[model samples]
Target: MCGIVGAIGSRNIVPVLTEGLKRLEYRGYDSCGVAVLKDGALQRARSTSRVAELQEQVQADGLGANLGIAHTRWATHGAPAVHNAHPHFSHGPGAEAPNTKPGHIALVHNGIIENHEELRAELQALGYLFLSQTDTEVIAHLVDHLYEGDLFAAVKAATLRLTGAYAIAVFCAHEPQRVVGARHGSPLVMGVGGVDAGERFLASDAMALAGVTDQIVYLEEGDVVDLQPGRHWIEQAQAGEGGAVAHVRISEAQRPVRTVTAHSGAVELGPYRHYMQKEIFEQPRAIADTLEGVEAITPTLFGTQAEQVFSQIDRVLILACGTSYYSGSTAKYWLESIAKIPCNVEIASEYRYRDSVPDARTLVVTISQSGETADTIAALKHARSLGMEHTLTICNVATSAMVRECKLAYVTRAGVEIGVASTKAFTTQLAGLFLLTLTLAKLRGHLNAEAEASYLKQLRHLPAALQAVLALEPQVVAWAEAFARKDNALFLGRGLHYPIGLEGALKLKEISYIHAEAYPAGELKHGPLALVTAEMPVVVVAPNDVLLEKLKSNMQEVKARGGELYVCADGDTHIHAEPGIHVIRMPEHYGALSPILHVVPLQLLAYHTACAKGTDVDKPRNLAKSVTVE
Candidate 1:
């Protein structure tokens, strides 16, 4: 993942880029850099540190430029270093000294260049020189090699040749007044700004354009825009000779700045040191926003274009990466039990490599918070190639590739997840997936009138139901202390709780540095019981539902082995309040809507346990917020 921004029509651009980078930094913070066109040449400055540090250096040097492209990189192709940072120079694969012009062209890129090695080899054979070892260097050389004196056309041609996910911003010496930008399977946004009576702004995401411009246009895949003084034009990006360009002009009054309120966990003053804590407090609002537009279904739940496909689909295949894959696993239970549909949940990275049986009638549901997960996008493309016309995405980032590729999109309004561990994104995705399940069940007529009415009532009541769950935080904190001295744990659930159990274990293991395992309440005897000891804590999800009795029995199994039990239970007096076991009361029943409520306790447990360990809860050790690069 990387953050990219460009400005051509404003005051000193370095400052604007700096501010924009701060907002976009959540996308990438491994390294930062800027490419500014000045005095008929391109000048570059960069850093292998945070944007705050780099901005300090840029200010100290008194660097000033009106138009430029800047970047904050999350290293994927190269190590984190100054030379490996963004704003990479494009001399050639091995260029000697032919194009040593100071400001010929400068650019920054996000996403991967799958054909980089091949392009580098060809350029090396042509005697093009290289600097740092990064796939982004190919964009620089591609721009230089395709320069036709017009920066926009050259950038467009370069994009046409390149294959894979990329959103790039470019500037050229010949066209110092403009910043040309393009996107292909990667996120990009064009912000309309009022700049000294003339100019344009382009950034990788809306956050970069937040204060600069309120009116922003999300660039579609295969689209390139020509940034000019006081005006800009968009050429529908085409691969070959037979292509058409669509010209659309935008005014500056549209892009408005989002005024974020000073929430309890938003700012880093002192107490809760990390942003992840701040974001945790914002979860309630985020969850509400995710349900805002989704509640109002249009003429068709899956959209008009996909209506016919949706009506014909017999099964569903959900492909995703990481946390979203877990969300898909949870959805599989809902779809199979509630919607009565046969569904498959596959990790996108693995799905693409395996042969499978899917066709026009088999709907493919892809889930992603960023919607830019490399394998997920590839899997979507693979399914589309196989004539699977019915497709949808449960996603957070609306500008991501999955949103553009999928026939139907369910957008999760969990805005700007900075922490790499994924907190609100996962919970909100579950909400979206749940809604999708309801929609599909209704569409297939499997949810009978009585069942549909109950589902709707539950859906409408979920937001408040989630609030009830959040109220259990104090109890969760008390329970986390039980595991203060333990290093390994086990999570148990039955039926639908099985997925929640897995998710709980994943959250604990991912950031808490604990080894945790989850199993169906009955499956513990199959194998996992051997690992349980007094030193190992076993967490039993005791939601007061049909499976509560079964889960309680499993808790006894842990206790029989002298394993400490932390039972997350509801006020079910039937739960055998055994000795050497801790009970944290969960929210009351919400029928099938329990998953949403079940997660809040686990989140609190994970958060407080990590706090007790004095770990870096937000940044962790080596994780990036979005996996923008493959």
Candidate 2:
């Protein structure tokens, strides 16, 4: 995934593009570049550095233009370097000969072009030389080859030959007044600013255009747009009378344009060393915002139609990816036990590729923080195509494609999470998913008045309970010192807390680059016990539950194998410090909602462990905050 931004107006647009690229750096930060159309020519600058460094390069070169496109690239088809960076240029054949100048056309792309190899061979035969080993370079050549005095028509025609997914923004030296953009599978939003003779902008996400404009419109699939100084229009590919591709439908109506307020303040880092640390400490406020107005256990907390949909559905099917999938896996236990509903959790990327029997009465629930994950959206659509109509989403973005596609939604107020490895988003998702579980229980007549009041009171006290857990950071940091010297780690849990074990392992591996794995504590003797040794550190999420005795037996198995133990024990478990064992006591055991509290300490453990190892905690290598591409 990559980030893109464009601006076309009379003002110097370097500051605008630079600020937008800085905001969108969460998408990717391997390399960044910018291209501007000025003085009837194209000027370019690229760097294998952060956006801030790219801005310095632009200023050093003294580049300014009224219209330009910028990109922050995450390389896929080639290594990350200056040659593979974006703003790829294409010059038509015969222009690079003696006494001739090459044509100038620059483009920035976000996704992959599958047919680039075949097209590149064809273009080479036509005397078009290539530069850089990138799939994006082929698109610029194709667009330049098809240009016939109209930039918009050439872009649409070039896209007709493209396969796979992409969201591209192109600028032409021949036509300096326009910027053309198109999206097939990636996300793109157009922003309108000022009034008459004002400015128009485009970005991969609305957050990049926060202060630039409040009026934005999301582009649908196969939609293309051309932005001028004070005007823009959208067009979608449609079919003709004979089932052939016909003329696109161009729409310029202002009524469909939606106004969205930006939360730029939420993304600022306030007294923390990194964004990951700031986000880990933001869990209390984020959870409070997610559970703000819930005073009773009602189905309307999800949406108005949630009650109707819950009544008609017989089973729950959760679809998610990454950490969101682990939250969904934990919810399966809650839905089956408290709501008395059969539930199944599936990985979104693998769900659509397999053959499975679909039941029409099943409710499809999707979980995501950005709400723009490509695989999750595709899996939701695939489930709907199989005649499963009841759909719901627990998402953080209010205007994302998932919210627009689903029938019901519960938007979590987690604000903005910029860390590549999620912290607050995971806990806030559990907050929303727990609310969904309670709503289903009420709709299914499984909750009594007494039980409803008890659960609500417990949920209200979660903020204080989480605060107590955060006080154990010093203990966790002490454990982290021993962990930093180890190369492998094992995590264990049982019953409802098992998924928390999996999440704990994931967090450590994501940021620290350590070899970590998780297994159900009961399943240790089956296969994983063979790998335990004195050098391998074992972490246990030992909450006080009915399975505590069985979990303790497993902990003893690790100790019997001469393995060092690091236990996150509850206050009443009586699992005290002993030889070859270390215990960090939790304040209180949260029953039926223990995953939310248990995960916080694991987050702190991973953060401090990565810190001691001197790794990049915020921008982990080869990981992106938003997985907008498959």
Total backbone collisions for each predicted model: 15, 0
**TM-score for candidate 2:** 0.97
Candidate 1 per-residue C-alpha lDDT over 390-422 given as tens digits, one digit per residue, 9 for 90 to 100: 889888877566887888887888877776667
Error of 1 at 474 (Å): 2.3
Task: Give per-residue CA lDDT, model 2, range 1-630, as digits (tens).
Answer: 599999898888988888899898866579989999889988888998888888888999998998999998988888998878888888678656343443667899988898999999988888776767999999999998899999989998888888978999998999989999999878898888843346888888888888888888889888888888878888786777887664476666632678998655237677887888888888888988999999998888878988888889999999999999999999999999999999999999999999988999999999999999989999999999999999999999999989988999999998888888999999999999998888888888898899999999988988888888988889999988888888999999998898999999999998888889999999999999999999999999999999999999999999999999999999999999998899989989889988999998899989999999999998889988889888
Task: Provide TM-scores for the models.
Answer: 0.87, 0.97
Residue ranges of candidate 1 with Cα displaced over 4 Å: 91-103, 125-129, 236-275, 287-309, 397-401, 414-416, 443-445, 481-486, 576-579
Stretches > 4 Å off in candidate 2? 95-102, 194-197, 250-255
Model 1's TM-score against the true structure:
0.87
